[model samples]
Target: MFTAVFNSFESGMIYAIMALGVYLTFRILDFPDLTVEGSFVTGASVAAIMIVNGYSPIIATLAALGAGFLAGILTGLLHTKGKVNPLLSGILVMIALYSINLRIMGTSNIPLLSQKTLLTNIQDAWAKTGIDDVLNGLLTAIGLGDSLPKTWSILLMMLVITVLIQVGMSVFLKTEIGLAIRATGDNEAMVKSFSAHTGNMKVLGLAISNALVAFSGALIAQYNGFSDIGMGIGMIVIGLASVIIGEAIFGAKTIVRATLAVIGGSLIYHFVVTLALRVDFLQTGDVKLITALIVIGALLLPLITEGRKVKARKKKRLMELQFDHKSLEEGK
Candidate 1:
């Protein structure tokens, strides 16, 4: 159970980055950007291709981000500049990126079984050098040998990365341009009232959102040791699931709280999915069904809450009407 939990968390942290990008679109910008599937693959393909060509892993990852940004910008342009419907624009870009991704791989898949990735390199260094082992032995002489595992390394990395993203997003949303972007989502006319360039804000927001997504994709491909074309399927659903689950569970009343909720919700979602897969009753064949159900639940939760409120209002109005009729009868 401990190992399973650890592995789930590790995987969840990677997916959480993708969830953050989704939150930006669905939660903050309230845009249904289905380009995630293609942008994700685009990032993964860029990273994998660059790494195969002997480029530094970090640079390759950045290149993937750039690719995602460009894809997002194209989507935004289609919607805003070309007057395409927002959702249709995303679908168009997503379809285009599929071919682009295939072209990047020059094939359908690029397995990283023998390739050196960021994780493998780090693990290799730790094993090749006896620094940690030696330190563990020294610490064991006292009382800290049990605490010597580098378990904190992955956790620390996730924390640092998540914090940076959250802080950066928060700061960005506060800037004049960022505020305008946010306003564009809330009220396009209000944005125009401020004389803000709505098109520019939309483009910027979409680009940044997908850039983060691409970065996550690159990281995931490196960590998972392969960049499969099919890996990005249902990514938008998963991201929407994360954002919905986060807001449902934690309530996105504040920016920081909402960001944290999305991360937490992603990990929780992965944990639940893993558990469901392991359950004998659910079985592996039910994975897709389970995912679909989870997504449906997330989507309906807000609506369910709103329905309850509506019912309560209706009841109150009915009681008020009854009271008015009774008083009028008495007066008559």
Candidate 2:
């Protein structure tokens, strides 16, 4: 059970990156950028190709970000410059990126199992000299074995990345440019009235959003030891599910809390999915169904709450009307 939970958390760390990107586009920019599916595979393909060509893992990851940024720029241009609908613009770019991803990989998939991943190489070097064992012994001596596991290297790296991004996003959103970008989402006309170029803000916001997503995809490919073209299917839904779940379970009342919720939500989503798989009664083979159900539940939760509120309001109004009728009858 512990191993399974740990595995889900590992998967969640990778997805937390994507969830943050989704938060940028959907929450900050208020743009439904469906380009996520293509952008994700594009990042994975670029990273896999670069790794195969002997590039440094970090540099390769940056390259993936660039590729995703370019895709986002194309979508932005279509919507802003060409005056195309934002949804259609994203769809067009997403479609184009599918072919681009194929070209990047030169095939449908690229496996990195035999290659040296950033984390694996670090672990290998640490294990070679028994440094990890020594560290574990020290940790155990301090009575911290359960709190801090022996396999802490990768977790440490992922935690640093997540924290840095959460802090960076909080700070960035406070900047003038970031404020303008956020305003474009809140009220494009009002921002335009203030001489702010809402179009440019949308472009910049989307570019940044996809860049983070691509970076996440690159890291995921390395961690998973493979880049599969089909891996990105239903990604947008999963992202939405994570966002909704995070917001539902851990109300997004603050920036820091919201970002943490996204990461936590990703882990929760993975844990729940794994749990469903373990269930003996469901008899479900299609994992996609799980994704669909998660998305449906997330999408409906707010509506359900709203419905209850409306019903309560109606009930209260009827009671008031009944009291007024009773008072009128008493007067008669």
Candidate 3:
């Protein structure tokens, strides 16, 4: 059980990066950039292929970011310059990227189990520096050293990286350019009135959003030790689940708060999924159905609770009015 929770948190951090991208386009830019579905596999394929070819993992990952950036720009241009509908523009780019990712990978899948990826590199560094032994000893003292996973170091590394990215996003959203991008989402016409170029803001925002999504994909490929053509399918829905769950539970009234909420949502989503999978009656194929049910419940729960509260308040108001009317009749 401990091992399951540990693995879930590590995987959650990687998914949170992609979720942050979704939040940027969905909540901040108010743009439904479905490019995410393709860009995710683009990142994984780019990184996997490069690593298999002996390139540094860092370079491979950054190249994935660049690929996703271009994908997003294409979608943005289609909408802003070509006068294409936003949803259709995303679909076009997403469809195009399917072939592009295959070309980059040169196959439907790229295995990296034998390759030295970023995760392996970090583990190697820790072993060489003697930090691994020290941490292992500490864990053993707490009785977790025996039961925890060999890749336990990944959780700490990912937690640090995730926090850094979240802080960076929070800071960026407070900057003038970030403010412009956010304002464009809130009111494109009003931003244009201020002499700001809303089109450029949209393009920039989309580029950044997809870049983060790709970065997350690269990390995921390294962690999973392989990349598949279909790995990105249904990812957008998962990202939305994280965003909605996070905002609903954590309350996203500010940018900092919202970013924190996204990370928390990702963790919670994974934990719940892990726990649900342990049910004796459930099979592995039921994961998507579980995801769908979780999302439906997350979305409807708040509304249902709010509706009940509204009814309660209305009943209370009616009772007060009735009591006042009866007192008036008695006095008369």
> Considering every candidate listed, which one attains the maximal TM-score?
3
**Clash list (residue pairs), candidate 3:** none
Number of backbone collisions per candidate = 0, 0, 0
Q: Candidates sorted by TM-score, descending order?
A: 3, 2, 1
User: lDDT by residue for model 2 over 1-332, one digit each (tens)?
Assistant: 55566677877888888888888888888999999999999999999999998998878989999988988888888999999988888889888888989999999999999998776876676567766678778877887666555465666678778778878987888799989988899899999999999999999989988888888898889988999998888888788888888887777887778888888878789888888877776645656788788767876787888799899999999999999999999999
Provide the lDDT at 220 for model 1: 89
Q: What is the lDDT of residue 121 in candidate 3?
A: 94
User: Candidate 3: where is the Cα deviation over 4 Å?
Assistant: 129-146, 305-332
lDDT of each: 0.84, 0.85, 0.91
Clashes of 2: 0
**What TM-score, to 2 decimals, does candidate 1 have?**
0.84
Off by over 4 Å in 1: 124-152, 300-332
lDDT of 3: 0.91
Ten contiguous residues minimizing lDDT sum, candidate 2: 147-156
| TM-score per model over all chains | 0.84, 0.85, 0.90
Tens digit per residue, CA lDDT, model 3, 216-302: 999999999999999999898889999989987887999999999999999999999999999989998898999999889889877
